[model samples]
Target: MSKEESFQNSVIRPVIKMLHDLLAVHFKHYMATKKLEFSQLSEKEKTNFIESSFNKDMAFRSEIRGLVIGHFSTEEFLLYATMQRGINKRINTILKERISSNRQNFVE
Candidate 1:
């Protein structure tokens, strides 16, 4: 696929889905762990909790809002892509170490 097409399908869509899933999972775990009483809070208090808990940086503020909030904007998805790239780089480094450690298996 072309760059733009791949960005739309692979980068944008997947990241949005992943972000949404992470948020939902976190909220559910928090509720179950804390036995939250959402009904006890006032309107402003509820909003405050939701925002403080869910409102992430530019990396997150947009994707969650896309599906949940009506007002959504581009919040530099590249920032997260950059972070993921760093994680993958770390994995590659570990893989490199393992291969080097077992290098004698390959040398004749």
Candidate 2:
């Protein structure tokens, strides 16, 4: 493996996998309360794509598994993972803008 690959295997990969797993659970729970799919990702169809692929080598997507995930119904366990992703994405976006504004002020 390249040095970067080795490093990821030793560090980054596991952390990402854990994050994916946690997000999977959160998404599962979030959808349960909502009753139906979020509607944003209806084209993707599979609710647990993010959760199920955490363990897969690709770290994200593969067609057969995705098709299978599409068949999997939502439950308390499934929605929590995706919900966590959504929350994280929002927080990160806010934080990024905050950091950028702070940097601009410091430059002035």
Candidate 3:
């Protein structure tokens, strides 16, 4: 597979999976802080909210990105730094999918 795909599978996916619970909690908190009634939204709307939140909220995006990136080793980080933009896009996409698929985890 490609270098990006390798790094994603080897590093990013595991880190995100390891932190899945934390991510869910953060998502719930994000909805609360934004005064969004996450439970009230339909499945489609919930998916759109997840997409729009990442697209529109830089602070929230960065915070989530930081959580995943912070777990990378120095070597993995160097690799990521070399292709920051592309890797970041991959990270966000994976994160969005993870969150969307695990939507049940966020329900109170």
Candidate 4:
């Protein structure tokens, strides 16, 4: 597969999976801070909220990015440094997909 795909599968996905509980906790805090009633939203609205949060909230996006990047090895980080933009997009996309798929986990 491609370099990006390889890095994503080996590094990004594992990081995301490993930090799943932390991500959920952060999402709950984000909802509380924003005064959003996450549990009240329908499935479709929940998905939309996840998409909109990443699109509109730079701080939340950055926090999520840091959580993933902080787990990378020295060599993996060096490779990521060479293609930050593309890797960032991949990271965000994967994060969005994971959060969207696991919306129930975010609710208390």
- Models 1 onward score TM values of 0.32, 0.26, 0.95, 0.95
**Tens digit of per-residue lDDT, candidate 3, span 1-108:** 988888999999999999998998999999989899888899889989999989999999999999999999999999999889989999999998898888888767
Global Cα RMSD, each model: 18.5, 17.4, 0.9, 0.9
**Separate clash counts for every candidate:** 0, 17, 0, 0
What is the Å distance of residue 39 in model 2 from its true position?
12
Candidate order by TM-score, decreasing, is 3, 4, 1, 2
Candidate lDDT scores, in order, read 0.41, 0.37, 0.92, 0.91
Residue-wise C-alpha lDDT for candidate 1, range 1-108, written one tens digit per residue: 544444445444444344544445544454455565655767566556555544433333343344322211344444334454543333233322332343232121
Clashing pairs in 4: none
Model 2 misplaced regions, further than 4 Å: 17-21, 29-44, 47-108
Q: Show the lowest summed lDDT stretch of 10 residues, model 2.
A: 99-108
Task: Name the lDDT of candidate 4.
Answer: 0.91
Q: Is candidate 1 or candidate 3 better by lDDT?
A: 3
Best by TM-score: 3
For model 1, what is the alpha-carbon lDDT of residue 71? 19
Per-residue accuracy of model 2 over 5-91 as CA lDDT, tens digit each: 443344333433334434344445534544644444543443243333333424223322232233334642254344544433333
Candidate 1 is scored at a TM of: 0.32
Worst 10 residues of 3 by lDDT: 99-108
Q: What is the lDDT of residue 83 in candidate 4?
A: 85
